[model samples]
Target: MSISDAKVDVVKDLKSEDAKWVKIQKVFYKDPNGKARDWEFASRQTRVEGSELDGVGILAILEKPTGPEVLLQRQFRPPVNGVVIEFPAGLLDKNETAEQCAERELLEETGYIGKAFSSSPIAFCDPGFCNTNLKLVQVSIDLNDPRNVNPKQQLEDGEFIENFTVPLKEFPEKLEALVSAGYILDARVQNIAAGIIVARKYSL
Candidate 1:
């Protein structure tokens, strides 16, 4: 379903005084050595539509005459209290496949329709801190495609995202530039940037 057709409602509010989307809990478990261990972790109480995965990150590439460019986004993140440089991403809707989520999120967050070329295995975002995880989907965009000539984003209420593109060859430099400008780099984007560097060095 399109973003406009999707329904997101606050069925109930069970948040703590210091919580919004997450809740913290402590658990005790036995380790491999049979030693008792206790740890605290945070979990999302919000309902997700599809797989239990947290969301999807898109490695969207646009084919341009000059070179292939990767799409990126700049958005203010409350956790960091600063802007972040990240790939277009969003949580999956109920019953939505990874590819479907990737496509929909790309359009919703970046105003670009993309075709999924490949997807990475489901991976954890921060196993030490949370159970949240996501799939990294590689997507392809044709700049000449008429559907993209004047694309428009379909962001949700209170969402503020700015999209931009950097040539694949300059992706690493762009990342450094963003860091120099005080933008936090999302781990998924950092990994993609590293891959780009490795591909160039080895002529992949």
Candidate 2:
């Protein structure tokens, strides 16, 4: 089934015990003036010991004669109740580094096997609402590679993602078009487009 047909029937609060990936808690802390305060926030429950990262986002770049094409996907996000465009991403497996997780997730979600070279520092997503942190990994995909020709996705059960590519230079314009077409852009996806705009404007 396509994400366009996905629907949510009801929404309800879930207890921390019933949650498999995340939990909510109110943390009490002392402010600068010794004032006691409590902050309610959500955090992941599956972090590997000694690891500060929760997940990795793959910034896959396909080498094309025209220009670099960024791999992106569209999926139904229950929180937003809409088909959202986002980069291929997933939580880290046991003992998996950010680069390793990025490569695995990229192949699973998009069917393109690529090599990860660089990664961003741990970046928090909606720090005010959750303690989820992830790294943006840059992966290089050589379309001329024999394996990349007609690659097939290996999504897990319940995953329904549609992958597509947009030229890097035209990503911002594509984002505008997608927004006008009633598709939600994930915050990280939007930020990448904004970064492209700023970089071009400043000749970076």
Candidate 3:
């Protein structure tokens, strides 16, 4: 799990007045099996004008005939080349709390207004390259209400999704299949799913 000879050599010093997704020069140093390998990478860095806010959202939903029901969305992400089942997530608007973002995304994506049981700070999705971070929110649903099963409204211009429910015990299998199919390439999501599995197993 350790990357050897990991070094960043700045090629160009970027300015803050640049537009989003500004390119900065970077040289990557890699020592593979004691051999020196140098690769130049054009790193992108941008100045986010707005204040940084925690992006909190729900994940690892579950549902059953009698037990607690959870919500999940099958997201059609073009970047990944297909649909991957995942929980509803969104960035917190400026001045908004992580809990508020979690509730908003849950309702907007899956049309469910459930309560967040536990939430995590906005952790780095990938520290090596991207500055994107996500706040992990754990939510418990109220299945007694019929509105929880309603169709969700897709807000993103081209967001195509399918909402579905499954028992908590079956989440790992679905996640595994998504990984096998190359839809879930983000390691952060995998790590979140592992934590979810531990949570559900202990709850039951």
Candidate 4:
């Protein structure tokens, strides 16, 4: 059959009322093999949905005037059932742009606000599920700016984060170790790598 001849046979809303952020729709495709084929070939369905989100992420790199020293955070992630060292990141709510989300997440997780430089969205940031895309925001922070850090606003309920600054020259090696040690998951690792690439390329 030609691609243009394809047609959707069914669609159902599978999202629960409690899932406010996304609306899930189950889509079914017609099977040309009919019922004679195995059960697996009978038909296919999936919950497809869109969210009220624009993607954003932080490359929250803290630098000292003399070189070296980059800010970073180690936080507990219940989904992984452990603590992981990662950059601050989150989604942009409705009516918010990617840049706005990046700034918000950085401050909320690191207690510091620096200049935020944004990059274009990358699909590699989210590969497993959800159409949500992400962009890198490089936050150039002033350690002496008291107005820049707010621990009270640095975290949300149920989140435990430890903030620290590491040497810029040591970041690549440290990231490699973290990945090799299985301390870094797919998305976080990919984002950090992308951030480094962008930072180097753009000199941001």
Candidate 5:
């Protein structure tokens, strides 16, 4: 079945006992003004031991004769009750580096093996609601690589992702169109697209 056929079967509040990947947490701290404050948010339970990061977002750039294209994906996200446009990403496993996670996730989700050149500082998602954090990993894919020819995805069961690319020059417009078409844009994707648009407009 396609993404359109993948609808949410049910919706309910998850019990703490049933939480396998996350947990509710409350933190009490003293504010700068000597006021005591408390905050409650959902925290991940899958972070590697001794590591603060929960995952890595892959920024896959494909080099083509015409120009560079950014590899992107569309997948069903049950939380939002819609399909989301997202960059390839996944949580880190034990003893896994962010770079290795980027390469593995990219290949599994998009069938593209890429070179992780760099990664950004940790960034959080919806700090008020959750403590989810991910590093943005920069990956480059060479179209000329023979192994890349007829690349095959290695997605796990129940994962349905559609991989495609748009020219980096037109990413902003393309992302806008996808939103208009009723696709939820992940915050990371939206911010990256906005960054490119702003940088090019100001010739940064």
Candidate 6:
């Protein structure tokens, strides 16, 4: 059944303090060993009724004479207290498809407009910690396009995202450099970087 068609009645309100984006709840479910257990988990309470995925992550690439370059963002996450290298991403708006969200977020955060070529299967950010999930979208940006010549970001207030590009061949080195410079790497970024290295090595 679709999310809109499903019934979701809150049995009880378990929070002492209300959070703007998330809610924690105590739940009972069957364990792997076939036993009943109680557990506490976080849910993204802002999800729209008809939305299938929680968010979208853009894997934007630009082709240059040297090689293909990947677009990345450097932002300071309050939870981590350090700058993190991450893909341009955003929570899906109501009734928005993953591809649409990818295109919009990429342009908003990086000032680069891209065409979404493909999308990955829906994946979870942290299944153990929360129900936050996202679909990774493959986007291509044409440097020859006039619109990208002098693009400008449309970031919201309080958002501080720096956009940068790294050659695909030098992605591993870039990750190392970011780490050595005390920047945290998002897991999705690290995995995609590794995939790029492998694809290059195998000529994929």
> Which candidate gets the maximum TM-score versus the true structure?
2
Q: Local distance difference test, per candidate?
A: 0.83, 0.93, 0.61, 0.60, 0.91, 0.86
Candidate 5 TM-score, C-alpha based: 0.96
| lDDT, candidate 5, 1-204, per-residue tens | 678667888988987669998899889999999999999889888888899999999999999999999999999998888899999999998889999999999888888889999999999988889989999999999989987888888989988989899999899999999999999999999999889878998999
Pick the winner on lDDT between candidates 2 and 4: 2
Off by over 4 Å in 3: 1-51, 60-65, 178-188, 196-204
lDDT, candidate 1, 1-204, per-residue tens? 221232334345554556777888888999999999999887775548545777789989999999999999888776656677888988878888888999999988777878998998999888888778889999999878898988899989978888889998888998998899767898888987798888988999
Q: Candidate 1: which stretches are off by over 4 Å?
A: 1-20, 47-50, 201-204
RMSD of each: 6.4, 1.0, 10.0, 12.5, 1.1, 9.2
Candidate 6 structure lDDT: 0.86
lDDT comparing candidate 5 with the true structure: 0.91
Q: 5 or 6, which is superior by TM-score?
A: 5
* Regions of candidate 6 where Cα sits further than 4 Å from its true position: 1-16, 197-204
TM-score of each model, in listed order: 0.86, 0.97, 0.65, 0.62, 0.96, 0.88
lDDT of 6 by residue, 91-189 (tens): 898878999999999989988889999999999888888889999999999989999998899999968888889987888889989899878899999
Q: Which tens-of-lDDT digit does each residue in 39-107 have in candidate 2?
A: 999999988888999999889999999999999999999989999999999999888889999999988
- Candidate 2 Cα deviation (angstroms), residue 200: 2.1
Error of 1 at 54 (Å): 2.0
Better of 1 and 6 by TM-score: 6
The backbone clash count of each candidate, in order, is 2, 0, 2, 2, 0, 0
Q: Tell me the tens digit of each residue's lDDT in model 3 across 1-204.
A: 211122344446556346365344455565757766655433334222374543654763544466654566666554445555666777667666777778777777767767777877657765555556677888766666687666467467745556766555565676687668755434545665687888887994
Q: TM-score rank, highest first?
A: 2, 5, 6, 1, 3, 4
Residue pairs clashing, model 1:
49-93, 49-94
User: How many residue pairs in model 2 have overlapping backbones?
Assistant: 0
